[model samples]
Target: MTPLGPLLLLGFISGHLTLTRSAKILTVVLVGGSHYLLFDEISHILHESGHNVSMLVQLGNPRIKGVNYTGRNNSYRVISWSANEEYISSFNSWFLEQQKSFFEGSESLSTFLKFMGHLALQCELILGDTSLMDSLTAEQFDIVLIDAFNPCSFLVAEKLRARFLAVHVSNFWSWYLAGLPSPISYVPAARSMLSDRMGFWERLKNSAMFLGSWLTERMLYSQFDHTIRKCFPPGSQPVLSELYLKAELSIYNTDFTLDFPRPLLPNVVYVGGLLSKPARPLPQDLEDIILTAGDEGFIVVTFGSMLASVNLPVVLEQINAAFSQLPQLVIWRHLHTHWPSGVLPAQNVKLVDWLPQNDLLGHPKTRLLVTHGGLNSLMEAVYHGVPVIGIPLFGDQFDNMVRAEAKGFGLTVQVNQLQALGNAMATVIEDKRYKASALTLSHIHRSHPFPPRQRLVQWVDHIVQHGGRHLRPFGLDQPWYQQYLLDIILFSLAIVSLAVYIVTHLLKFAVGYLCSGGKLKVA
Candidate 1:
């Protein structure tokens, strides 16, 4: 061949190799709300990075209505299994009832266990669908990224027989599942709502919470096990806990700048603020409102997506009353239709059906954020250097608020204490310390060598290109007793006990001989 012909052939070969290097990634989205958003973000990132990405969306929650389950606008394909309308209505009703119980302070262990049962039912529905399973198996995905909030994702990964990575939306569950060391002496438990700096009683409470959480997790696993056995062949059924350890990596949606310092394995990566971006110009209407507020600025109030659906008239009145006391404009995320019949929003408060949360937080005129303490919102607040007043509702929200408060960037008021909402907002807004700490945290979070999205994409690419087996710790494969070194401690204790028994006998015999003037005493 001529020189030019050889050069053209070489370029063609290089392009082919680059295309072949792209991995086929299947993201399992079982639930919705923030969990779906996180997985969607990951799918898009991987797809943008030249990977073949597909999303497997199994609708489990009715609350996730109107979401684009399919990657319609994206280049990747989407395979979705939507639940029946009746089932969706039932699930939505049950979920709202649970929320009501939580607001009324009547939520019990039984209610939580019942919720776990609901999750199991949803998993069972997906697994029972033969066509869906066949379609997923045919894809032959290279790896799976699972939302670790629901145990069902583990079973899905197992059914696909693919190496998987877990995306933990909160700070704590993945640590417990992956056998990562979490010292209850300082590290707070999942929903304990306690900070790392604990006195004696607080530490005891943390320890108790950890044990309770472990037990609850086991119970949840057992519920999933029934589905596993029912769906899979006898020998092929995989243990949920084992699948958790089998994850190549666990990406936590948290950062140390916002979360308390804790032990992490090499395979664990913190990719908080994946959805955060630089502020874009707000719509003219919102801009005009901000301008009208002058130097007093504005406050953003949102109780997250799901909580916005909940109707707490008393709580709403209290919030409106509190916002009325402020000089700043309050842009609250609440449906105009859902507004209470008689109650009216304060003159300073602007009620909208939806608001651009990240954009609002990033705005120069934004002063404080009144949130329900979702991790995503908190991370955005930290990213934008905005102080918060958390009105934590449930789940990890309480713990997240605790961390925010411990970091000195915010404070929390319980839902029952809506009366304190105004005062808490005033404190965070007036005190320069909170804002300074938030700015410092933002600096630390942004000062990383690479951004969180970059870290997520790079680490995921690294794991997919090269298996993460070497990155996993040996302890992940060990039994619980071995992981804690309980077996070694027990063996050492046994040896020490035997030696003491012999030594004590020898000493007694010597004393008896001396006392008896060299004559042996008969028993």
Candidate 2:
């Protein structure tokens, strides 16, 4: 509506400022192996959206050029993290607490504090090594989104006064996030009790857990906050502190298709199926074998990427005994040596170091799935509507297997119990309910509220493009003392008020007594 010359100039300037600005540098801080699943999807999204992406993974894998390093395997990574004596000692103490944890519901206050202490220490060291320090020193990033487990990366963002978002690689409430979820339950990655959704009893248990867990984390943050302040001078500089104070957004790497009846946050975007997308093409030989299997039907056996290569000879024997009997040919993803030389490669069985998991699952003739119940594998099964026989080893596998079993799409049998393994597999393969249930679940999985990868990319790009002001965690901006809701302060005030009232009454009584010549009672 302005004058012609001025309006034209203003529009041109606006377009030039926005459209011609240099691309922003987005620094992504990934904390674990699973974090790859989340960032992998977001990476393509960000690049296409016109931002430069640099990744800082604590345990980097070479597959991603941005990742700085990779572990030889899970054991090697575990060893690397354990190299620190205090961390090793503390981890050992918490690691063995699994039995006690099962009885107590989830991690208790001491257990959680111990776990957090180890994680914070490990993250700090790992972050420094991953070139995250370089990004911070350069102050090059417009936004830093950290997978939440690595609180140290958050510390780094806070150091640089950059806007940050917390990325959760696992299920919601499965890891500790400050403020949200209420009362602060100790929901470790593998909570022994419920998923993010809580029932009446679960709510009660979590309420207690929240109180205890809150105290422990409070103590943990106290130590870490000091280190954070030291890391960035004038973290005291209110301007910088204000900018870095909160997480811009939280992204949940889950497809609503797979996770149901699970409570989630409005801010949380489920991008779970991101990992299920096509990556490298399946080898030709592998493709042929899978296509042939699809013709008559076959069962796929996988123990997930981490645990499959697990050197548990006993578990292998148990699985072998059961798979050898199915009507369908077995496609086994074996890690250690070729299916135990001469165990008789039955015409109905095929052995390989790996299989094109998604392709195979998507193939029509795939009949059954025998898994270790890792979340990624479990979700894949749901997406494909394949019946599952779960042999849970540890972590959330047990809970996942239990849920799958309860859902009627699968059955759970402990790896140690070979008989249970055989029986459960027989039931799922033969029973109609499991198959029907699997199909129904597949329908739900496919019918999720949105396209997972697209949503993930959308939200991720939103943060980078908008400069992160929209996604920051507003809760922590308030003081910790306020968050804790310190009743002690209230009690102290009440006591002072009561004391003044009593003292005033007593002085009046004394004055009246002296005037009337009555003695006061003294104890």
Candidate 3:
């Protein structure tokens, strides 16, 4: 062949390889709101990378109804299974009650357990739909990425016979699932509300919290056993805990700069700020408000999407009163229709049904953030160098706020202490140190050798291209007893006990012989 012919052949072979390299990826989205949005961002990233991505969406939460879970202009395929209206209503009722209980400080362990039961029932609904499962299986996906909150996703991945990775919407729980070492000495347990710097009593409490979390997870997983058996053949049912360990990768939506230092395995990746990007221009109305604020700038207040429908009249009154005391314009994310009957927002406070949170946070005129301490919000605040006043409600919110406070960029007040909200906001805004610390963190988060999105995409590509088995530690396959070296400890204890017994008897014989004047005594 001529030189030009060889070049043409090489180009054709390269194109063929590129076409063959694209993998078919399936993302399981079980919950709605921010959880759904996180998965959507992941699917979009993969789709942009030339992978054929499909999303399996289960509309389990009625609160997220009518919103486009997927972006308006997207190329990825979506397969959705929405629950019946009756189920949706029941879920919505339970969710509102749960929110009320949390705000009232009346939520208990039993309530959380009931929520787990709801998850199991949702899983049953998903698996019982034979046509949906058949359609998913027909796709023959190369890999599955699941939201780690629901154990049912593990079962779904099992049913599809695909290797899977877990995407934890927060920084904590997935550590346990990945079997990552979490020494209670420094790494605080999930939702324990303790920071890495723990005193003696705090350490004890942290350890207890770890035990409680482990028990809670076991109880949570046990609720799904019946569903597993009902859905799978007798011998083929997947063990929920085992499925957790089988994950090829555990991707946490947290960054080390924002999270406390902790040990992580090779398969664990932190992609905290994947959703963060450069700020876009705000709408004209919002821009006008920003311009009117002048030297004071504005404060952004949002309690996250889950709490959008929940109205706490007492808390609302306190917050409204607090916002009235501030000089800065308060851009609060609360439905005007759901505003408490008698509580009136101050003239400086702007109440809107919806606001572009990221854009507002990134705006130069934005001074402070009043948040529910969700990880996503915290990450965005850190990304934009904005200080925060966290009013943590539930789940990992408390812990996320603790991390922010520990990092010196924020302070937290309980829901009951809503009166302190204004003071905390004032402190964060007036204290130059808080702003300096936040800017430092933002720089560190942005200055990492690789950005979060790139890390997520590269690690995922690596796992899909070469498989993640080699990256997994051998200890994950070992039994719990072996993992803790319990057998070795037992053997060592036995040997010591036997030696002690022999030495004691010999000492007795020697003493008896000496007391008997060297005479032997017959038994």
Candidate 4:
């Protein structure tokens, strides 16, 4: 009871903010592939506000060859960290090999371990180098913007003595693992393919998956903590959970308009399209092709960076077949070097190694997007009012596509069900409701009082100016068993058991006394 009193008081008052002036920001983006877009935009925003901004990033990772920065602002200086190219290539190979296993639910425990180990090693490479760590520590950043996916970055924040910490998460479900309320009754796990509205059986499955996912996250955190501890002096480093719980705010690449309505903490901000910009005019070749398609607009297809390694000939044939049946011109962003010899592309179809995804989605002639349901692509689609045919391959993609379908903005078909893709495409194209719903959501997405970038900057500045010490939930201080009131449950059970035992014994004594009295009367 005494412990709870302080917790309640602290939590009640923690929501209050102590506003201060702006701050010098340091952005740490460890996932340096396509994910760099998130940080680049953030750094640009901070830089625009006359704040001193510096970045620590891995230059080894690139989503598209020859194009490293989508909108790299020259104002912010970058500290590049390089890794062995061969090693990075091998790591990507391992990731590619596991995609099928991940989708099939057959991914081995070793695969998961190796992946985390790889991230840990990447951290080691940076933190292990004395000169780099020293340089970073000397920066004395006011605030550190870190990717939530890379828990190891917390050690850097600690070393730099950063005043405040904010996290950017590419996938939203991971936030649930950070001690937020995500009821299994309705909230779907990141990998879950189920919609928010579920039947009894589906609810049961969601609960089971929730428990499993939580356990897996705990294990991963343990690994990260163990690795991070080694980098710091003994007894000084905090565990991964502490770092997450201490975060003042989190910027999720998700919005309520595209997602099912659910409870969220005030500290959790949705700046889903912070990286999005006004669409640029299409490249001349693409413009020419798009213009030639008279009344029937064009379709854009892309599967994102990780899945770009797909070289399945049968899948290519299926895609080609579907495209041939449609009258609309198609711009397929295929990644493999050689086109499959088995199928001839339709006259209306064009293949490219890469495409400006956001720009294409924004084009007026583009009516539909065939995507893998990655969050970035979905956000872009929603921003542009473009409907989607999501063929989720793995990970949070399945969940993202499901939400899209539930929201009436898109439809989803299994990647293997290539035959049905054409029908799914036809249904979405012929149905005006999909486009109308997408446009509605786009309006909602854009209707925030403050633009996403401004909102992000303001929140970050708030945390920096005010220590944000109060934002920590009181539940974090309580023990997990106590937080769930398991102790109270046990105490109540004991009380009930004692009452039943006393009542039964008293009845037995009364019965025994009656028997004795009867015996005495008979005598």
Candidate 5:
């Protein structure tokens, strides 16, 4: 055959072949964890959607260390770094110190900053690791999901050249960092114990606390910036303010029902119970205990993971004392296997190192929960329609309990008040309104337009498609003074000053003219 005939046959053979392309699956990297529960839930959801998700967590995190990560099909890969365990221990120790240590240290501001500094220091364990950073950069993640708690994650994301950044504040009321309105006139600080409704004097105190905390935190961020530059080889130093401003999406672990009505940016989403899942079947022994309680019901007590370090033997004693008189069986999730000689458990009280809290709260026999008012525990109680006796120690716990009280579903006792525990527990148990209110809130929470997980995923996808740049308000771009319109105030003051000066000068001139023209013509 001729050469032209052979070429035509080869073209016909090539036309029979088909070409195919698959959709690009986004790669998401989650860095930073002291609050792994929130991150874990989000990572799994993203992974299930066929996206590649990896988490770089601190080995020092007790929650992350305890969880089992090995399995078939595997939810997500967890990469961890072992920093100094002492850093974690010291941070925990600070929480357990007398509450006075927080308010009366060298300077309460400095003390608070130091605690934050310790957390920032932990980030160095990941940021300074050249090998890990190289591997992460090679993976070329599409986005970086960071716990708002660790501001240093900003550096990691920048170094990896990630396309987008999303921050999840595992707790509520993210201070001024989120660029959302948190008016001191009504909205309380994250750590504050004040309620949204306050008297004039109380509002003044709140304002002072707010201003002081905001200023101090700004100073703290400077220190964090220094650490970020020192730990990482720095060409481009990202200021903390820039990170907050550039954040494509920010999620707070707070619901409007629990939080005060404050103006929020479109970028901010409240997903309070995102970590919550349907209660799993309880252990056989624990199930037996609940079943035995019958109509009398049982009380669940837990101060969360930090309780093991809390030195408040007095608080434990009061809790025990109160349970002794109640008809309800008490299930106290005490971390220690043995109680001190001075600490005695009531006959009706069972002390276990851990409890399936969600399952326990959902049980028919769980009448009341005596909690430290941690957001996680409070949301669980609200989710299950259980009343609470809140003894908040610090951080957002106090504000959480205050919200519960305002909603009529719970009451708070002073952390150290031995006498008030009995009354608090009695009120929660005897009052029917508490249970009714809790049920109402539970219904409202369940009936929200979007479940927490769905809201989270929707926002993540929204940011991926839209880049979320429009969600950032113009207010964030303005300078601090301009954002508050201080210039307008200054201009108004200048105009008033000029008007007053002109009036005074005109009066002087009129008097001078009359005197000069011999107004003594009356003679």
Candidate 6:
């Protein structure tokens, strides 16, 4: 092929050929931690493309946002993920196994009070500090596209009454943002049944996740309602439920190419792979190290931002015991200084504070990765054709790992059990099936034309240009229990019981009166 052919292909992928103008859209992006990164990154691209974007960074510290929207320079900003202030250790409690936290704690009265307090703090911090409320009312945004975690967006959305679009970082949170709560954060279940191919137990596992999430979120929202009621006089809560329910449309940060049987809603859009930015140059030493590994391939181990350097004592020892003997080079990320005793670092065992992940994964010497099963890491592996050995800690990690395992992409390690971790990783390293599966998914993940950013930018433009209100779910107009209908059935049954009782009493009275002067006696 001529050089012109390569240039044309590059043009197509880079979106230099078919780029469109972005709308001047003001959006309240509610990022719930790193989960919001993909949407933020892509939407930023849209901002650069030609639209105006205001990012509400509800979760993460400011990283250099990926790119500007197509025609417009990106104007990225942060918003609080929730309408509540979360201090250190406050957010950590979500990883609590029993599913109990301030949001789901035993102190009903206290939890209620704190959530209310948190809401005020949230309003003051998220709205007041961020100047979100003013921006909403003054800037008069056409739409509000929020991350799954950003409850603050609901209030601003109500104030602005803009059209709302929900951007789900993944399926698990999508369930909650979709008004169907979930306990597992990593596993994004579909809205429909094609996902049932994972079988009954898997589905049951998903249901359990929903149960946990439902119970917890219900508590917080209820508390949030009480707090909102307190903050404003009667009739001024600004449609708090709307943010949770009124997403005109949803952008899923998942590639359908990888997650098959992806159940979609009419309002939901699949805009995955929006965060793929081509990597920078790799260091010479790193390239040489990778080349040295050869056919045996190398392993990249990273635990995402949330649970870095947890108190898990056994993890280090087990990793050392396993990696020391292996021919492949091992790259591990341990943020803390503490290392397990008696473990000498072997030539193949490499420790890093951090490594250029995308670069290494794309390298010829790379083969496998050992991660905590973060969606970000999972996407990275699939995109780079590197299999994983997952050590799932909590949230959606377990579910994500399970899906990867099902897809033959990698093995999973139990967080606490070192034996399980070692065994699971062995399978990943020894098995070529894992590598093959990962490569297939990589091809699928990248097959989409125009990076995810282009799609997101277009949608943002559409919402802004059309007025975002039209992008909402008709379902949100219904009340909570009414949407589920459990209360309606119960209420109907109660009415039937009352009618039955009245008829029975009247009939008995008539029968007695006909028989004996209409007088009735108590038993």
The candidate scoring highest on lDDT is 3
lDDT tens string, model 2, 3-122?
798889999999756643434444454333345545644654555555555555444221222122232221101112223566556654555454234323353456555556665666
- The C-alpha local distance difference test score for the whole of candidate 2 amounts to 0.60
Candidate 3 lDDT trough over 10 residues, lowest sum: 63-72
lDDT of 3 by residue, 232-273 (tens): 999888888889989999999999989999989998988999
In the range 402-432, model 4's lDDT, one tens digit per residue, is 8899889899988667789999998999999
lDDT of 5 by residue, 1-523 (tens): 8979989998877643311111122222332222665676667777775567777766554452112232225777776766666766776556446343421222245665766676577666667888988988887666678766667667667667675555554454565767887778888765567788899988988888887777766887776766767775666667777777677777788787666677778888888887556788888998888776778899998766545434345656766888898888899876554456678688999877777778889887888998878787888888888999887765556678889998889998875465788877888889899999999999988889999888876677666666777888888889989999999999999999999999999998788779878453433
Residue 1, candidate 3: alpha-carbon lDDT:
86
* Full-model lDDT, candidate 3: 0.87
Considering TM-score, which of the candidate structures 4 and 5 is the better prediction for this target?
4
Tens digit per residue, CA lDDT, model 6, 136-246: 567665566665554555665655656677666664444556554232333444322223354667667666755665566656666556445644457666545545656
Question: Between which residue pairs do clashes occur in model 5?
Answer: none
Candidate 1 lDDT over residue span 81-103, tens digit each? 87799988898888888776666
Among these predictions, the greatest TM-score belongs to 3
Query: Which has the better lDDT: candidate 3, or candidate 6?
Result: 3
TM-score of each: 0.93, 0.68, 0.95, 0.88, 0.85, 0.71
Q: What would the TM-score be for candidate 1 when compared with the true structure?
A: 0.93
Q: What's the TM for model 6?
A: 0.71
lDDT of 4 at 352: 78
> Which residue pairs of candidate 4 clash?
none
